[model samples]
Target: MIDLRIRTARPDEATRVLVFWKEAAEGTSVTDDVDGVTRLISRDPEALILAESDGLLVGSVIAGYDGWRCSLYRLAVLPSHRRRGVSRALLEAAERRFAAVGGRRGDAMVLEANEQAHGAWAAAGYRKENHWRRWVKPFAGPSRPV
Candidate 1:
């Protein structure tokens, strides 16, 4: 919808991409940083895709497949462009990317408290598992490098 063109994000798309990620993950600690995101995108290169329409960036998704599992993160569609299937199209593109990388299935980590994200992920064919659990530990001030 809206004549979208989805492709791998370029090196210079950091600012807009940061805004998009912050908005998409509101209340979360995910900050938008051009250099940081650029590095992340450059790491896998093809996993980060951007969606543009009429020459304006409108949506983005970080899709990565590590042979064991296909993961999607930071899916964001600008408020003005929501509900026009922009996000859905971005999701489909990620699915295709996952398939291309030999991923047998797709997976994503939506903040459990974010119902809207859960709904969208479900709509995109992800199911919730009642038996699964996640673990986390926070370092006092800064997280150590993984």
Candidate 2:
């Protein structure tokens, strides 16, 4: 096990976080930019959890709780830090956050093609729900006032 410290991300660290994700994360999302990250931190400071070891950012996990559901995303660890209990520690922190927020169940968005991530998630006791599939529709243009 490594000496790990888990905490919520600070707003100014968004750019650094984005760079880290580019190297550590398996895939990209529509909102994988500085603006998106900044918005996330500004809106829900605790949603983005980061793991550090010896003052170095090593892993991250987004534990977003929208009052009713706990949604996990971007569980990433540096390639050099894999198998070092980083992911486990991150997930534990996320789960603790969920419990504190009255979240009933937690669901993660894992890429189907990332077989390596599948094992990590499974080890953390997250199983796939084959009965349901994620459906997404991306907006190509700017958002309009509702």
Candidate 3:
């Protein structure tokens, strides 16, 4: 039997949450560090939920609702937790929260090149917005003299 507990992230548990975030995103993201993730979670713990099993954190999904739009991101489920219904449960929980807060709709900006994530999101009912084209400028951060 798979034992799972889902709850809103606590301020102090952001570190552990980021650990699972990096693991699930192993080769797919550039900003996979804890520092940036910690900053985001701290700003809104209510939008972040964690799934734990056997005292080990395994899944997480963050929802951000800014009145007009709601976004779901940083969704991750450890390898061991995949296909055990963790991801689905976590996603459903996120949707509920979004709805409760009057979020008009939910959106996820999945990398088009990441087929795995695309497939999962598609199966979970996310449709491609055909009108959108993503643009990225890596390391487009504050310039500092080295």
Candidate with best TM-score? 2
lDDT of 2: 0.92
> Candidate order by lDDT, highest to lowest?
2, 1, 3
Write candidate 3's Cα lDDT for 1-146 as tens digits: 26889898776675676667667853434544566556666777678888889888888887877778889887788986677777788888989999899887898867666677776787788888999876665674444311
C-alpha RMSD in Å of predicted model 3 compared with the true structure: 3.7
- TM values, all candidates: 0.84, 0.94, 0.81
lDDT of 3 at 50: 83
Q: Please, what's the RMSD in Å of model 2? A: 3.4
Off by over 4 Å in 1: 27-32, 137-146
What tens-digit string does per-residue lDDT give for candidate 1 at 29-79?
A: 322456668877778888888889998878888898767998887777777
Candidate that beats the other on lDDT, 2 or 3, i.e. the better one: 2
Q: How many collisions between residues are there in candidate 3? A: 0
Per-candidate Cα lDDT values, in order, are 0.77, 0.92, 0.75
Which candidate's lDDT is highest? 2
Tell me how far the alpha carbon of residue 45 in candidate 2 is from the true structure, in angstroms, after superposition.
Answer: 0.5
